[model samples]
Target: MRKIILLLLLSAFISGCSSLSKSQIETVQQFGEVTSNFSAYPSAIMEELAEIRLKRGLYYASTLTDPMRHLDELDSIYSQKKYDYKVSEKIDVTFRVLDKYAQSLVLLSSGDYTANLQNNAAEFGVGMDSLVNLYNVKSNAEKLPAGIGEALGKIVGFSGDRYIKVKQSEKIKEYVTKADTLVLIMTSNLLEYLESSNLEELISYEEKMIRRNYLTYLQLTDTGTFESQREYLDLKSNLDAAKDLKALTIQSTKDLQAAHKELVQVVQKKQKLHSTIKELRVFYQQVAEIRETLNALKKDK
Candidate 1:
C-alpha cells in the first residue's frame, strides 16, 4: 500500500512538471520572430512621411513668390526641430523597447538558455532596463513598472542543466499578465498614429498636387511630350504604391496587436496552443509579404 501511494505521488508530480509542451514553446518562438520582424515598420512609416513632405515642398517651390527663398525655408523647416521628426524619434524608441522584450522572449524559449543561464539572464535584464529608461526619456512618460524587469529576470534566472517546462509556464504566465497592458499601450499608440488624419491629409494633398501639375502641363502644351506623360505616370505609380503600403502597414500592425493578445490568453491557458498557432502563422505570412513589398519599394527608389 505504501509503495503504491509513493508511485502515485511521483506520477502526479511528473505530469504537473510537463505543463508546457514542445509545440507550445515552438509557437512562442514563432511569435517572437514575427514581433522582431514587425518592429521596423513604424519607424519606416515615419521616414516615408518625411520623404513625402520634402518631395511635396520641392514640387511646389516654383509657385512661391521667391522660389529660392521658399526652397531655403523648406530646408530649414525640415532640418531643425520639426514636430513630426520629434514624434518619429519617440516612435522609434517605443518600438525599440518592444523589440527588446520580444528578443528576451525568444531567448527564454530557446534551447540555448540552458548554457550560461545566469549570465544570459542578467545580460538580458540589463538590456531591458536600458530600453525602459530610454522609453521614459524619449516619451516624457513615467518609467515602466520595475516589476516587468523583475519578473523577466526571474524567468531567466532559474538554475538547472535541464530547462524546466513547468517553471517556464509559471514565469511566462506571470510576465505576460503583467506585460499585457504595456504591450497594448504601445500597440494602441501605433494604431492611433497610423489612423490619424495627418498621413491621409498628406497623401491627399500630394495626389491633388500631382494631378494639378500634370493637368496644367497638358493644357499649356496642347498634348504633353512623351517625357512629361511618363513623368506623370511614374508619379502616379509611386503614389499608388505608397497608398497600398499604408493599408498593408495598418493591417499588419493590427495583426501584431491581436497576436500578442492571443499570446496572453495562451499563456494563461485560456486558449489552446493550436488555435494560437494558426493565428501566429497567418501573422508571419502577412509580415513576410510586407517585407517583400518594402524591399521592392526600396529597390525602386
Candidate 2:
C-alpha cells in the first residue's frame, strides 16, 4: 500500500511539470508575435510617409523656379519687340529646357525611391510649411518690380517744401526698409530651419550636383554667400550624429512609445534645417533680382 501511494505522488508531480513547460512556450510565442506585428506596422507606415515627404519637397523646389521662367518670358517678349529674333529664339529654347528640367524634378520627386523607415513623418509637414512660406516670399518679391516704378513716380512727383521732401524721403525709406525687413525675416527663418534640421547630411551628399545652383543665386544676392563646402562638412557631422541617434533609437525600439517620441524629435530638427536651406535659396534669388534691377537703372541713367 505504501509503494502504491508513492508511485501515485510521483506521477502527479511529472504531470504538473509538463503543463508548466507548455504554458511557458505559449507565452513566449505570443510575445514574439506581438513584437513582430508592432515592428512591421510602424516601419511600413514611416517608410511610406518619408517617401511622400521627400517627393513633395523636391517638387516644391522645382516649382520655386516659376519666377525665373516668367523672367525669361519677359525677356523674350522684349527681344521680340526689338526684332531680335535670334535672342528671342534662344530665350525660348532655354525656357523649354528649364521647363523640361522642372518636369524631370517633379518626376524624380514622385518616383518610387527608398527612404529610411525610421524617419519621422510629422516633421515632414513642418518642412512643407517652410517651403510654402518660401513660395509666398518669392511671389511677393516678383511683384515688387511692378510696384517699384509706381512707388518711384510717387516719390518724384511729390513737389513740396524742403520739409515735405524730407518727410517723403523718410516715408520712402520706411517702405524700402520694410520690404528689406521682410526679405531678411524670410531668409533668417529658412537658415534657422536648416541649422535645426538634421537633413544637412542628406543635402551634403547631393551638394556636388547642387553646387552650381548654390553659386548662381549667391552671385545674384547680397544676402551673404552659402558655403557649399561648409554645408557639406556640416552634413558629414550630422550624418555621424545621426548614426548615434539611430543606435539609440533602435535600442529603444522595443519600447515603442519612447522610441517613437525620440525619433520624432530627431526628424523635426532635420526638417527644420531642410526648410531653412530652401528659404535661403529663395532669398538669394530675390536679392539677385533686386541687384539686377539696380544695375539696369544705373545703365539707363
Winner by lDDT: 1
Q: Candidate 1, 96: how far from true, in Å?
A: 1.7
TM-scores of all predicted structures: 0.75, 0.20
Cα lDDT for residue 45, model 2? Answer: 21
Q: Name model 2 segments beyond 4 Å from true.
A: 1-217, 220-222, 225-237, 240-301
Per TM-score, the best of the predicted structures is 1
lDDT of each: 0.67, 0.32
Write the residue-wise lDDT of candidate 1 on 109-172 in tens digits. 7765564664675677677777776777767544575546556676544433333556666666
Clashes of 2: 9
